[model samples]
Target: MPYHIDLFAVFILLGVVQAIFLSFFFLSRENRKNDVNFFQGLMLLSMAACILEIFLMYTGYIVDCLFLVDFSEPFALAIGPSFYLMIRSLIHGSVSRKMQLVHYIFPVVYFFLLIPFLIQSNDFKYNSWVYAYHPNLPFRDVSVGYDPRWLWVTDHHTLMSLVSIGIYFLFGLVEVIRAFKEKRESFFAPVHSVLKKLRSGILHMTSATVIIFVVKYLNIDDTGDHLFAAYISFTIYLTSFNVISHSGFFRQVALSEPQKYKSSGVTADAQKELLDKLAMLMTRDKPFLQSGFSLPELAGKLNTTVHVLSQVINDGLGKSFFEMVAEYRVEEAKRLLKEQPHVKVEEIAEQVGYNSKSSFNTAFKKISGKTPSEFRSA
Candidate 1:
């Protein structure tokens, strides 16, 4: 078998390489400890596998390696579930084990269904590939010594792939919408700008996948697969660009000033008054208990600007806004840990405005010199 390469193949191979790198980056020991990173890494890996298979087929290299034919079908099936899990982890901080099992059922079943094809002879697999891609070339009659009905799922693999991804796409979109609604913020609001961008990216990627699959299905063969592969490459490039742009590596650093707030016109008396009001609010209302509580929201409640509130927190309280909030939260966690010893540490984390236990533990240890468990045990 002869291998072929072209500009399209080269472009797609570049994407494949980048996707694989990103997958490993996210799955690295430092990153994969976070559930969001774990799921996102799995999604990227699945996508990279699918794109790699497409690249090999497009370049006519799969003909020489018949055993690798259609090997990415399970990975393709996995893409949707991983994507949905990543979104869920992002919004909720972690996915339950049951939810992960439920989401992966289809991929697991699809892999089992492909066992027959996977075990077929090289002649059979080669004919399958040739029939799908090189239709104009000479044909070879081969048999797998079994009824083709055993592989009915593979016969409709394209439709199944679309349906799988489409369903998960809906699931992910609904999750995003629900998160926005729960926050009581409009889609146009800046409070959820991160989630808004995530939703936008997922929407664009899913929409493009649907369009590409529809076109591939209509083409009735692997002829238009190069286009699908190219689209995947474009998405990979877009993802990489987004990551690099937001990584802050290229951002310019500003010089430190001796007196950062010297120009602030807030009088000493006004600062004392603002500090009193903030203290009252923190003690009486405990706005920090709200998981989505933010500096802007606190400013709104206190009838002051965000900058002023930040200044008051930093200068008057001698801590940054987040550090102040974390102190309050950790204090609350300490109370809960002592009074409700039977309650799980995870529950305490949530009650104290933490989205994940790891963050709660870090903040607790930072402020109290003990983890929540250690504090509770003591």
Candidate 2:
């Protein structure tokens, strides 16, 4: 087969375009606390690495020869954990600082090990580990040589990296599944299948990594099948795409005790504006649907503060945040039960605001004078 594409240039252009849009999506930046911010920055950095990898491919900077190979050293290494962190954040609502530090261990060690090679190259020379020559023609063969140490480091790094990401995926996958199971028991989301989709995404990423490793082992240490390796690299990058695509990251950001709602000093106009926001959240945002949703969560997503959000829900909505949210959830359950008869009563509990099935049932009974099953059966 003739490998006739300039994958180096094409990959870079494609990645840069995606990164630019990703940056735009991150502009609002709601999850800006501690490890969340770090993970977000890490994602951007990973995408930058992909962009750099592309540059290296086009410039022949990483390879000693004139071709590209399948195994990515530092580039896709960072990208893998970034995906893991994104999923972790989505399911758990936070990142582990200690784990994030641990995630960097192998990549940092690899960078140091490569320093000797990196410094030896100048603008005229390539500072790369995997390279090939005469790619993709029937008569062509690719040749790639690495620092003897790379054989050890890259091999160990691949294993270590895959394990780290698997731990993260397991972390998110378990919580998400558990959450769904609880929701199911409560008779909420009886037919909702997001749980399966989340599991599938994690599995797909793992499968892609495994496939890459198998290809690497067979590709013969970066010298043969350069184009085939490029194909694998492309697959790895696509996996990264799946890891970050979601609305889980979006939040309403709330900052402080707004002077606008202050009883002693807030201006009438300011109070009016805040009241409008409060009304808007209840009607438009429907934050009540979130099970763990609280004043702080709402405020954080809104980029505001708890005191103000509390005041809005209380003073503006004429109810406490809990009551406001609970009321809406009950109404939501009623609507779902009425419209979607096939869904079970346990599903209604989860689909609304209750975490456990029992909690959902209790809340539903308390509010509606009917257990979820009774309500559904009605």
Candidate 3:
């Protein structure tokens, strides 16, 4: 109640608002019900709650209302695991339920450890807030003489969080590096682009964590300028949201469905029949020539599930749906380039199922190793 709203408080308050908005925004997406969305939303919610508590403390509201002091730990403990889980989901595509439970163990244990403080009497809480945690008290003195229980909960929580996040960041870095090293050249360029963004995201998060750790280690966190941490956190969330929004996660396409493939046994004979039918469909019917053609539509025409078709494309044909489509479109574009040398590249692109000239150029270059105009000339 005694604190005034300064510039630092205003910025951190804005970060808190943004984090909260992003959390619900991701959570509300019906199509994105997977580890990626769930973990990212959980991470945002955790960060929002922690930042809100910091904002409250910075505004001196925590001092006025003693109960808030006991609420921050649960959210704080959740940050490390949520962050790790989010990255894991992005890299691995999905996380097992057992692994999810394993990540949550620390936060759950820490939550129960705070039970004693949560049940404290109002008078005791008030006295503790006034005498032990008064804003006027020096930061150094606040933890030095406190009840070990309080010290253990607060100090250990901060230390454990740094360690946990740091360890996960290192693990995520290894996963990103491995992903790059193991990447196949034949993957769809669009999917490859998304993977590159994911790699950058992993590095960005690791760098942010390092900065936060450095600030904490240098005791910059003690200067009451919690704005530094809030700004860094906001940057991370903003970058993550942009990447996720554009990465096709929000689409109806199944990115993280656990049961992507069903157990319908397609025998060797069935597979060859399906392959022949697929060849006829592509060569004769030319479904890929249609604008906005999708896997579901093609699967329906073939009288098969999307999963079965996807497996046939990925395992049987050794190509993704995007790759297959792009290959056909680019080959058609090349034929047009040879036949109608006077036609514009954009016109050819539209004729060959590409909506944008840029996309056509990218796909053409990726497939043929030359731009559309270059292909035309050569």
Candidate 4:
């Protein structure tokens, strides 16, 4: 077989570039705010590394430099965990260190499994790459360079990759569904849109992984490589599409911003007082009516730390910052719609801090069981 860069190879290379740029863009300070962005960056970076391995293999670089091949296997193993963490953080705010360690067990195990292959002599690796897998290739005599044991290693990697991604994909789907339900009940317009985009991306990525895993599991020997190439290319393309479309992933605030309150030692009574003050501030000042309002700004106005305010909003009030803001904005929109019947929907949306009328409508409908128009007409 002649080794050449095909269209799939081009796509794989493009995917690598796109993923790396997105990863770096998300990891940079401008994009880094919350665990969601951090994990999204990790996912994109992992994807770039994995796809780069594929690109190298198809381009025959892996044959020239066998050491580079081992990294791909572990990187491929990392996709499931990275993807899971990204979605989990998007839905759940932040993940615990223990959970992160638990999710990485598969990648760690795969890294150890590749130890034997990694320690092999360069000549041994090059020979194995040329003759161990590819059949009927020129300048490589299969009988002289082939290692029978390598087939088992490759097969194990494939099997484990399938199982890991399948499990995590299902787990991710559950989380997405749970988040959808919560968002519906909570009326968080800003984050609801974010959740919808996140769910769509997760579903697409998960479907691609599932299709590839199922095809590989079926073990169609003749077309397996071709199928793998096509599916992997599709997966990369889908991921690139998602990253481009769901730009909200890059806008999240960091999880560690609330770290200052970890040892603040505020008692229950003090938290209650803060909550009352927060209520008074929201009721009297109507700060949520301000466009681009933030938890830090709210905390500052209340003469409190962001950590304590965040804790009060999340734990004491059982609402996220966005949810609380949406609640107030929706109520304000209701009053305006009721009193100012002649006002335009867009103007009303602008007045209530929703930059988008659709967002305002979504929040209104979610909270009042009617769109702004319907509410006004009633």
**Winning candidate number (TM-score):** 1
lDDT of 3 by residue, 229-284 (tens): 56655674565567465543334434354453334344444455556567757876
Query: What CA RMSD would you report for each candidate?
Result: 12.0, 13.1, 15.7, 15.1
Put down candidate 1 lDDT per residue, 22-114, tens digits, no spaces.
889888885675677788788888888888888888898887788988889989889888888888766655677899999898889888888
Model 4 reaches what TM-score against the true structure?
Answer: 0.58
Q: Model 4, which residues run further than 4 Å from truth? A: 137-155, 184-191, 218-378
CA lDDT, every prediction? 0.80, 0.56, 0.70, 0.71
Better of 1 and 3 by lDDT: 1
Candidate 1 — which residues are off by over 4 angstroms? 148-151, 188-190, 251-378
Cα error, candidate 4, residue 109 (Å)? 3.7
Candidate 4: which pairs clash?
Answer: 33-253, 33-254, 34-253, 34-254
Look at candidate 2 and tell me the lDDT of residue 289: 77
lDDT tens digits, residue span 189-225, model 4 = 4244446556666756766776676666675332244
What's the lDDT for residue 243 in model 3? 46
Q: Considering summed lDDT, which 10 consecutive residues are worst modelled in model 1?
A: 248-257
Each candidate's clash count: 0, 25, 0, 4
What does candidate 1 score on TM? 0.68
Better of 1 and 2 by lDDT: 1
- Lowest summed lDDT window (length 10), candidate 4: 140-149
Error (Å) of candidate 3 at residue 307 is: 13
**Sort order, lDDT high to low:** 1, 4, 3, 2
